[model samples]
Target: MPMSFYAQSTVQGTVTDAGTGQPIPGVNIIVQGTSNGSTTDFDGNYSITNVNNGDTLVFSYVGFVPQEIPFTGQGRINIVLQEDAAELEQVVVIGYGTTRKKDLTGSVALITAEDFNTGNNVTPENLVNGRVAGVTINTQGGPAGNSEIRIRGGASLNASNDPLIVVDGLPLNDPRDLSNGSRSILSTINPNDIESFSVLKDASAAAIYGNRGANGVIIITTKRGKKKLQVSLDSNTTVETLTDKVDVFSANEFRSFVQANFPDRVDLLGNANTDWQDEIYQDAFSANHNLSVSGSLLGDILPARVSIGRSDLEGLRKTSKFERTTSSVSLNPRLFNNHLKIDVNANLNFEKNRFAPGVEGAAIVFDPTQPVLDPASPYEGYFEYLNGSGFALNNVPRNPVAQLLQTRQIANVRRYFGNVKFDYQLHFFPDLRAVLNLGVDNSTTKRFEERSTQSATGFNASQGDF
Candidate 1:
């Protein structure tokens, strides 16, 4: 069987200049403000279907004027776009001033905003991963975790090895100040807030920072609101398993090793347990949440921004847990016809670390096979006397329950950091801006551990804070 459809009417159009009456070649004709439309051929003739009575057709041309014509259901329309001569006068912001790309003396690479937003990355280091030629970013192990970046090559050895970090013409706080234990302070920042970042590598480009610029400098510009208020949201959740676990004896192997080696020491031969490493590590989960909103301050009062972030990490160990939360707000005020500016940023972070006895020392030596010191389980120093073959001559098994119940440990660290800046532009060298930057950072960490009377290390406990 054959199916047939028929068109009862046709819609047609021709576009021409109103004054000259000459056909406008290659004109784009579309239904007004809708996805339905078509373009005119070299002869400026176009036709469309599916438009009912009183439907409107829009005609457009790139260089000429643009206009819309209403259809009496016949569907013929024309448009004219005025020549926008002002397009040629556009000036791009380059370096300290505006210049055409052809007129620039230095080589600079620009990354489109679209590419930056659509990238699959959890940190700024990851954002630039394979895109740059001379830059390299390496992650130690986990996702949404710390990354090590090297531009060209490393410069620092021990003290103050990190490259300079500058924001809005203000140098960042010393990298050495943030080295708590072994972690870097730069890891605390969220990559999503960055609008763009530029790295200055050559000596000619980095000389401005003077002595501190030897290692190179990175400039980070955070996002700012535009005319029409816009809001964006970001959230990610990651589940991580241990990439590598310690290789050690299993429960059966450990029992066999103990029984074979400590036959003479019946105490140790009778009470062997699983390797401690197997009991401590576990699958971990982490999550990140971020929200931000930016818009122009009404009538040039001030540009303000607020952001909040939180992270939760739970390790595989049943008794081990770690978590961190942080919040920050920033404001930039322009005064005196944008000649003078003041910027202030405040940030706070709170972390809680809780640990239990399993991962620590001493608790590992006790054997679960031996009778624990519970009231219901009778004391059994007698069975410890039973001799077994392949036992070591002098080895004693410690009580398992005393080792589990006797150890306790906990620690917490709190840190706060902030900075303020004032900048004044010079009249002679308009490109020259002098800035006074001040910052403060402080952290306190406390840890405590206690061992009960049965442990061999009890004598060392009273000595305090090891």
Candidate 2:
């Protein structure tokens, strides 16, 4: 029988930092070109079995340069790892330019999509909340609302304290454009398309924009296509309810308290004891869906992405609802050996807002003894107060339930934003490049407010457009 020469050997070694000379724990030791691997123990000692003379061993650790060594019949081998300066000097996007983190002169925070919060994020700001230090994201108008981002607090007294948003080399709309209350252009952007966020916190990094960057600057880079075709679909739904309800008196408690305090006026109380807070508030629901496809084409890479999203939200108050629909398309193509690149992006958003009247004030002040519906009154089905006459009583505020049903405030907004950018690198000087960008942002808003003749306010219907 022929003698078998194949044999396996165990290799043991310790890994240490070159500069500190301290043992580095959790170092990964892998047999090159094979699935076998091991990790260093607390003493930085790693042992791997089944090692051959020609086999290669790979040692790797975070923040340390990886090293590969051939077994070469050695049973014990010790290795020192040098710190990876390149990993520490990652690239950072600044205003009008990109710089290495080691070369940066000002405070800047970089956040990528991978680091974004996981959940049903409806807006870009929602993805950034609580992730970056010194960045405060204040949700302005409840669920699916716009956010106010302040880096290191407000710097301006009268001017807009919100950061200047630059998306894909184009300046976004004015942050102070809150014409629709708490809705802003940032809410229109699809968070899935975002690749990274770079926040310039100090003047040294944001001074390039002059006055516009006084409060700071947020740079948003959208995702680009990869070398291969890829498709992704994401969908989620969210249910929301008021977390902290006002600690007001319950129906029975309010009735007994009113009877005890105002004994003479006890007759003023209605036959029914109602909970106005419960009647006005409700559980709100919202959902979102996104689909994207990206790929390269021919010699040149052409990536096109289209996304559609919708959100329907019901406020704590009845009849107070906000619905928004957003659709966006981005096309990017590289030509001339990637020297010339063109990008075209278009976004359209439509919103419908129905606001409940007097819910904020009347819902809290309306008499709890009054029933939700007054059957005998002319407004028989609605909750209202009336004397012998059919008209609404003037002494007290309009019934909260009647106010929500009889009065209506509806706002419909249609907004469009489009931009085309061309970047061409000079053939003569490969390092030099020129860019031309043109963008348009337009919005139309129409508002309709009507107070029914039965409403206590008795205001005529009004319509306005902007």
Candidate 3:
């Protein structure tokens, strides 16, 4: 029994994309000229046990160039794969179908994930900023505000100029806010899950959409699984501050101007000088997180993505704050030898906003020489004007600071968007296919406002829901 002994070892390794440094899953790994084979997991990790030291392993994946390595008694071996340029040709998604880049006859622009804008972009429109020609993106309002995208300028004088948005084969209605026009629907979408964007600018390119395409058309396609399995996570945080402010007369400058211009009314100057603008402005913050997983099983591909985001913004004016929470999920599955495909996308968004009182407007017109608070007046401890007799002054807008602190307006909005699509190609004829799609968009909003009873406008409270 003093005989010979054979030693066995275990081999483990990871596969990654050389270009993007991302993991590649579902890759096939086999021992050369042997039946021993294994597949990588979602994390791009694979292991083979009971292997000899001199065994040669082969790594192969679709759309990528394969590589071979010898297991020189090492426990771990990592490999990088290069993409096959020939297999990476451009693919365009049109109104009702898809076409290769060389087959397109109309003027169209394609934007892939690699071309998206970097940073904390809350809306999909922001992702395309300064990336496309003849297209403009304008952000309205403050930090958590929505963006307005214009393609080739205005298309109509009396009608809406917004382009039609189509997501994963389903057309979305205009995301306009009829009441007060303060909100936009595109703000609910998660930009991290977008795979590509197709813009139809010319009349010939948008003719397929008919009347809705007059303004333009944008088709959004989300990510899906390939021949490999992959898992990825992304997160970031941001801090925001006022970039520039309007130049206003300082306390001493205003006093000097008033004394020189209105010598007779010099007594109108208050004892204290305050900068109303500085009293209201504050800082804001935001954070975002995203996770995605995709792989293949039993000759079928499954891809899923989820994202969670939150933003808290403080406006330059006091009591002006906006908070929003967004979440979304996308799932895609392929079955029946690639003949059956199903895609489901769902999103949920919630927003809360507290608008400043007349303070923001009054800060510009209110007397800068006036004191922020009065001690002996009837409205003690509150910013106000009073006469020598200890009575409240009249015929003037309420103190900007008092208006900001005493009045309250709160708005809450909840929105949900979901869609499901199915496609089946006939086994007899691969060219012919049948499709079914269903979708829904729903939103609810509630607003509450209240004014103090001691204010000049008296007590007032109102609530609305839609």
What would the per-residue lDDT of candidate 3 be over residues 18-109, giving only the tens digit for each residue? Answer: 99898999999998989988989999999987677678999999768889998778999899999876544688888857776656788778
Global lDDT scores for all candidate models: 0.55, 0.78, 0.75
lDDT (0-100) at residue 96 of candidate 2? 60
Put down candidate 1 lDDT per residue, 302-405, tens digits, no spaces. 77777776666555554345555666666777887777877777766665554444433432554434433333321222112112431211345434334434
lDDT of 2 by residue, 251-326 (tens): 6777788788978887877777787778877788777777777776663477777677777767667787777787
Question: Cα miss at 415, model 3 (Å)?
Answer: 1.4
- lDDT of candidate 3 at residue 124, scale 0 to 100: 82
Q: Pick the candidate with the highest lDDT.
A: 2
lDDT of 3 at 341: 84
- RMSD to truth, every model: 12.8, 10.1, 15.2
Candidates' TM-scores? Answer: 0.55, 0.77, 0.72
Output the better candidate (1/2) by lDDT: 2
Candidate 2: count the clashes. Answer: 0
